[model samples]
Target: MSATRTFLMELHCEEIPARFLTPLWENFVHLLEDKLEAWFPTGDSANYRKNAIDNSTGLYSPRKLAWRLVGLPAVQPDQTETQVGPPQRMCVGEDGKPTIQGLKFAEKWGMDFSAVRFEQPAGKKEPCAVVTLTKQGRPTVDLLAEALPGLIAGLHVPKAMRWGNSEFEFVRPIRNILCLFGDQVVPITVDGVTATNTTWGHRLYHREHPAPVVIATPGVYESALETAGVAVSVEARRTRIAQQLETLAAEVKGRVVADAELLDTLAEIVEFPKIVRGDFPADFLELPKEVLVTSLREHQKSFCIEGPDGALLPCFLTAANRTDDPAGFVKAGNEWVLKARLYDARFFFAEDRKHPLSDRLEKLMALTFQRELGSYHDKTGRVVALVKHFASRMSDDTDHIDRALEAARMAKCDLRTLMVGEFPELQGIMGGEYLRHEGAHEEVWMAVKEHYRPVGADDAIPGTPLGCLLSLCDKLDTVAGCFAVGLIPSGSKDPLALRRAGQGIVRILWERGWAFPPADLIAAALRVVGAKATKPTAETNEALMDFFRDRVAYQLELAGYAGSVRRSALAAGWEDLVDLKARCEALSAFAEDTRFASLAQSAKRIGNILKDEAPSTDFDDSLLAQPVEKVLAACLMKLELAPDQASLLHALANLAGPLEAFFNAVMVKCEDPALRAARLSLLHRLRQAFLRVADFSLWQ
Candidate 1:
């Protein structure tokens, strides 16, 4: 074996979209790292694998991605080979010479006849014959030549494109492939482009002598690229951009308001950090903050700045590809583009409010929610009904219920407005704003605004009670509508994001501790669905409840509940998520006690014993022949359950000793018929007490 060293690969292509750059680079590196470990587990890889595979930074910028792996063996280690063939008795005839079978085997294996030797068996009388084939391991560079391109192909991109006359498809057009193994080029062709050790820097940023810089070794890649004016590290680039934006924002007594996703996208779109401040008309600030921020950030790839008091300022920051912007050309261009966008937004805001949001409700009939689920108008009616049901669960106040129903009635009206038609993300916000413009109540419009509060796990839930009720109703109506039409989410495929809605439901219920039965709400929602549904509602109710059960289990699992506890709670049947969670908590806590181990074992034993015996709920004390049977029966009859899980668990805790003794003394399968029936009856009673919590045997 030869010594190990580092390998490098850099792929430069046509400019990749900001959204595709990071994921493409990450997917390629992940697949390539797995290939590296599996192909070359060298002697030094044992100590440095963590740093090499997981911790190594992936260097990617616009149009380029690269990786430098250390401690990679030059070639695979040699391995021994053994092949077993026919028995020795069959290989040689009675004359003790090679038979026709032996010659045929030798010919088939492409080996000399004399090389097929006989070997004796350790425990058998006859000797078995074997043949060994020495398979030579290939060079690491050669293996990489075969594996790397396929690994690159395995990267997950939404779509691939064809460029020029090449048959190969990739996210973008390939311009260069830089592959180096210990300073030597590992040559391979991908779509007519051959890899070399030479790489190019930023096309126009460098002031150096030439841009085609040669990386002498993999260890000095960053330094080499630095000379070519390319910042290869994404972290360094992001920090540089963030620091610049902060400095620029502080000049105006404001802070940069950029999300993580926007920053990441900006980080991928530029090779060198260059941020310029631009301004728009102050009248644009009159529009909703979301409209201004979305207009700037979504299309222009810029950042919004906010004053200390939370009001958005007139200035925005846009990243540039080049640092030297003479005469402020980039700034002037960005300012002009933002001015036009704000003018359009100002127009949309004006035209949308001319008739008020209420008038848009009649127009929603032309817009269908689904082909068979009727229009958004019909959905609004069902959502109003569901809101009434959910609001009654928490508060009996007439005002609260009426406000929630009124909020639901106006929920989907914004979809028909002009502002929402232009900026779809401002649906709820525009609705609330329009309602406030009409002098509606705060509770009504606030609920309308926040009904979609939590679109994901990271998002915030509704703050108001009316908002919470309306959100639940809206999500449940969508889920019921989809399920009624057979649009159920399958494995890894949720086209309608039903999983998010379901997760949001479980999160809200579990966090708020609202006392509502999930089954009853699901049935009620289905009733609303059944009335307007095109298909029969016979199976949709049961199917949706089952989906809810699976999601509840998933939600609890994610909350760090032990699988055993969840199973135990689910064993009782899932009707209410809050109650199921409470029972699981009580049972999990009880399992930690010292007395629980023996009782659980006894509980498990009771189930095993009753497996073959016919169950009888009727306990005949007249047939009792033992003292333990009478004691067990007496304790079970006195067993009383309270409304709370803790109280029930406490009652269950008392019977553990008596039940343990009954199993210790009384043989359930006695010879006499009456004694056997009596003992089985006693065990049956004990089993019923445990089932109040869970199928305890399942926990064991």
Candidate 2:
């Protein structure tokens, strides 16, 4: 082992996008450290010397990025080998002659049958043979060379590009590769680039200097790049950009909005960051606030500054490649870019307002959301119907429901608009904006915006009652329609994002305290589906119901309900969404009580014994000849037949006494034909009565 010291490294390339730089560099550093640890564990910090691998692993801000891994181990550990066969007890039994189980075990381990040796004592009850074993570990050098290539292969671009005759993929063309172990070159090659002890720095500034920069250790990597006019560390670059922005904003008596996303983008865009503050025309501030901000950030990659009260100022701050000219050049260039983007935005906004929201919806009817499923217009109609149905079930406000229906009717209208067609993510948001401009009712306008609530798991649900209803109805129609068309989501592949829609439904239900049975909502949706469905079959409907049921079970399980509780409640036949939840709650409570388990166990046992016998239609009291039968009948008579809460508890309580006594005295499977039939009939009566509470068989 040699003394540890800092090493410097670099990789140069053609222009690469700013966004690709950060992730690429991070991945490279992670892979390098992981490979180092796998090769040498104990000497990770102590024995290894500082080293430089790639200065910018893949950090390319429309140019290049590399990595610098310091403190790498010089050599790997010595190898050890071991091998073992079967367990001792299997080889020999009492008075052993090599047991059959032992022979099979030996065959599985690929051991020779002749190697077995049994030991026995005169007074011993059993004897066993121990199998010999050896173990071996692979040489570290071979592992390092083999594993590093695959780890490097795992590096990827958000989007890849093709170049020349090679089949390799990267964000841009791979021009070179650099690999080193302390001062020695690792002698590895990938994607037509060979690893070396040399790297390049600041391609544009050192255009004539193409010689590879030799770095001996990692500590020198960043300092060397700084001297060569490059910021090798992405974090260092980000910090510099943030600090510069803050300082620039203070001078102007305003604060930068400090959008994390914008900061990240800026960090990757420059290796040597130089913040340049520029101002746009005050007249352009007349544009919509969103338009103004989007123009600056999207086109110029600039951060917007705001006054102390939180209003956008006319000025913007941007990062440049370096402080080359320091004043006129960067500002002039950024302002030019902002002006072009804002000009286009202003043009589009004025042109789009010429047509009203309703007029746009009329044109949107021609666009199809799915080929066989129907158009956006068709979906809107289903949503309207679902919203009405949803509203009918609620005891809230009729006026709000009407407004929600109107909003749903007009929700997809923005799909036909020029502005929304360009920015699809702003679909529902634009609909609300357009409706407000048209002077529609406030409730109607708000519903249009809220209808698309919960686009993702973490997104907010509609806050208002009407908005909540609209969101649920819209999402349900999407899920039901997708299921109807046989376009159901599969593992990690929701082509239509139907699972997201289903999640939105669950979220809305939970948020609004609308504890309707998921099964009932699914059934209602299926009913709507049934009417609209041209193809009909019991099998298809069953498949659709099964899909919804699985999602329901998944949602409940994810919410932390036990499997047995879900089965128990579902077995009780709850179709109302709210009712099913209540049943699950009741069952969960009952499950915790010790007596309930015994009762459930008893029900399960009786269900198993009478499994072969068909349920009795008639409970003839004449069968009460047996003491158990007489007692069970009398108890059933005393319990009130309440189907809901009070009655459910009463019925469950009544069965407990008879159930216990029946199990104690009666043997249902009697040898005598007449007596067995009578006893079987009594058990069937109990099963039928018990089913009124829950189907115990489902618990199994």
Candidate 3:
């Protein structure tokens, strides 16, 4: 028996990018756990490994990544090694003595001939000569010393660089390595840095305490860092920053504009957080709310504060990695920098308002959408045409159709603006603001602004009918044009974000309950793209439809639909996404009924029996010989064609009893070919009815 101990390891380096910290820490922890589990496997060793992983904590900041594991075994469990040799016939002679081949086999395994025994391995019928040996467990400290160097060197980050004269590549230069097993240091070296039990504190806050802090044990690692003005735990730092932001915002009778992403980035970039509130000129509020927030968040990494009325308060909060700022130097510097950015934004806004949004349309001729797809000017023409095609199908109001067309024409004009040149994230948003400032129609301006909604998985779709119409046209044109030019997305190589664009299209259609078939939409988009399409129309149409089907399946899975239900519904028909969703929900709800399994199995059996036969519903009822066959035929005829999906599912479930009885009592393949054909046609009719709701043959 061996006692359990705690293990800790830390890598101190130059500041890593804020986005790379979380992923690097996660991979590092996962790799360590996998290695430890593989090295220690046995009765008590399993429990110790489980405890270590369950109690582990990953510490990550821009400057450090560390892990602390508790209850790890001090030594690996003993293992057994087995070697198989020549077959029994080769190893034994007629008198049951060792043959010359057997002696060499035993010598190869470093065992005496007497130690070899005849045994049959599992799953093998013949006996073979085998030898078994026991290996003693090694100390955990020794294993760590041998594994740590390679593990540290193999950590992956998006972009890595080499520093100084060393050939080692890392996200940042390694300054120190700290490792400990219980109270003893683990002697390991990574690149040129050697492991120790000492770590430094916050670079700025702990300048007065320049000496390194010695960690006596894994149990006191976090507390030791805390005493030296470093908060080692990421969650603790985030909570502290959040509380400081709220407290400061409350002091000025305002609330901090909540941005979870910014909070996370700030947490990763700081060791200790101190919040400072700074003010800009109230005239900056004349700019749109989005511009103010974007400038503060993107340019300065600061948080905006809003008044109780939900309007901008002209104040912002910035988090500094320090204990305090008694003279307000940090606050002054942040305020000055933010004011300069706001001044530039105001200038751009004034200049952009000089012309109507429609006047910028000609500027798009210089911007290429894609080399094969012509310029943004050409794309706008396609979009306007697509909007007309889709709008006519969806609505009859001429005013609505004209508004969508107008929005399509001016959507890409903002890309040429100075404000958008500085902040590319505000492309669609700035266009809408300029339109509104020039007294454009409310519907037109809003439609332009929201055309790029649902940019990612968790984002919202366009809020208005016209907005959704415009968004669909824009996204569809891009996807269809790219597919036309043979730029389809494959594997992970979607440089144009075709997958995201496709998903946005599906989401907008499904969420809005629009009943357009995917093929029809693809055809319309291709027609708008006209002669630019090089691929055959039928081929491109098929590939685009399959792509849309995949997006629909992905979205359904995210919404918690089962694979069987999705496949069954999709196989029946996926022309209308709204109808597909309804069928899926109906099938899912019906799955809870007591008769579901029998009905599904019956449908599967019918499909299998009629696999290659194409039988029509016009079967001769007079040829039905058995009573069971007649009863099934009558039940099929009596099935009420229900208008709603749930009623249809219930109607399908009613055939289970008759189907079971028919299969049990009747044999379809008879001596008379005509009789067999009639029975097959009857079964085909039943399968067709089931196909209306779902292809139950695909049911698990």
Output the number of the TM-score-best candidate. 3
lDDT of each: 0.80, 0.68, 0.88
- Considering lDDT, which of the candidate structures 1 and 3 is the better prediction for this target? 3
Provide the TM-score for each candidate, comma-separated: 0.88, 0.67, 0.96
Give the per-residue lDDT digits (tens) of candidate 3, residues 27-61.
88888888888888778888888888887765877
Model 2 TM-score (2 dp)? 0.67
User: What tens digits encode model 1's per-residue C-alpha lDDT throughout 530-634?
Assistant: 756655676787788788888788877877777777777788766676777788888877876666656678888988899978868886887887788788777
TM-score, candidate 1, is 0.88
Clashes of each: 0, 39, 0
Q: Which has the better TM-score: candidate 1, or candidate 3?
A: 3
Pairs of colliding residues, candidate 3 = none
1-700 per-residue lDDT for model 2 (tens digits): 5333332233456777765676777776777666655455454433362233433344344555555455443344443323343445766668856678778756765676666555553555555443455434343334545665676667776888768888877777766665544555556666778767656666665776666666665556557667777886677888899999999998989999867888888877777888988988888777655566666776788888888987788899998787464558888988887888777867777777798888876676699877766788877877788888878778577776777678878888878876666566667777887788789898888788767888876678887877888888888877776676667777889878888788788767755668666666666676666655544535545765666566566656765777777776666664455666666665665655555555677778878888867756565677556677688766665543555653564456556767787788877787866667767776676666666556655654
List ranges where model 3 is wrong by over 4 Å.
Answer: 41-55, 123-125, 638-640
- Top candidate (lDDT): 3
